[model samples]
Target: MSEIPGLRSAAGEQQGRQIPPASLARLTIYLRALNSLLAEGIERVSSDELAEAAGVNSPMLRKDLSYLGSYGTRGVGYDVQYLNSQISTALGLSQDWRVAIVGAGNLGRALAGYSGFQSRGFEVVALFDADQLIVGTEVGWLRVSPVQDLATVLGRTRANMAVLAVPAGVAQSLCDELVDAGITSILSFAPVVLQIPDHVQLRKVDMATELQILAYHAQRAQDPDLESGPRARAAQ
Candidate 1:
């Protein structure tokens, strides 16, 4: 790992800063870009270069990184390894996250087999399904367990995080079960609104909604009148 210069003292100031949602999202992108830079054996990165790597404007990247305290020098830019560590700590990536995937369908199996999750500190410890035939099957290194044993498997694996790749119809019930079984953080790929306890953090990824948004953007790009509209510019 490369060393970061001059900003070690500012590390303490990053705590308790309330980064806006938009900035929080961008920080993840910056982290990915920084990781790529590190893999290339690059040690230092200028704000402009880093921003371009992250696919964001320099000013926006700077603004996003402000929540974590400035670590870049006037001419030398940021230290890649140090910045990566700082971002990782900020995002709780330093801690071990055991993830259990509910519904060992195609999506669940794919997510379980993803190499990126393990590289980023998320371990897929368990996989569950309602089908008896699928339950005993192996997905990656993990054997799919029966959904009836959800709580039991979670306890055995000491899982703290969960992913719901189940259908929308059964998503809510499974989510409730996960919360009841002591899981606190959940990422749901199911396209439905779930009622979770306030203490449980839930994040929903609706692929259909994302596709619809993409369709809207495509339509706007093809239409001369829509292309010049204020709404289209705002969307961009």
Candidate 2:
């Protein structure tokens, strides 16, 4: 909530424009809260109430919202519908984005079958895998194609984004292939760090990392003083 003094820099400012990651992430929370408000037929919301619903502080929420321009009223707060639209527009969710899934394993198959993608303006157009046994197989309404056919599928489907669900060892190769195939965005599930171009956007979802985080919480729950010596060993 502290003032971001250099936020609104001059046109010729030497410093790079930096928007806080927390502020950017809060847009998603705002969208969800606004959606809930819309479902409940609520038209307007105060900063304090919206922040509480989004599990964030009011000043922080106000500062984040300010980056999108002045949409809040002096006393009445913000118009729920308008604010929702603004956030969606800022996140580039106003239009449908085509997505392809590489590696048609259980995780990939599940992603291809997920209904949430459609609701979020992401359409799964193709599924790819190197395994011949799984290739040509049907997953939901889409057919799994050979990994060699990735370029062809990308060209045919015009997908700008791809989801990599391959194993850790093969994830890098798959990512390279996707980049070569003109994919600008990648959502990888494997537990490997990828080398990608500056123009490419890579998002990783490591289940192992999530499990480790959960394990940490579980360990702490078993022994609150786990940070110290004997307690930590006991917690483990």
| Reference-based lDDT, each prediction | 0.88, 0.83
Task: Report the Cα RMSD per candidate.
Answer: 2.2, 6.4
Candidate 2 lDDT score relative to the true structure: 0.83
Alpha-carbon TM-score of each model against the true structure: 0.92, 0.83
RMSD, model 2, all Cα superposed? 6.4
Runs of candidate 1 with Cα error greater than 4 angstroms are: 1-3, 6-11, 226-236
Highest lDDT scorer: 1
lDDT of 2 at 96: 79
Candidate 1 has its poorest 10 consecutive residues by lDDT at 226-235
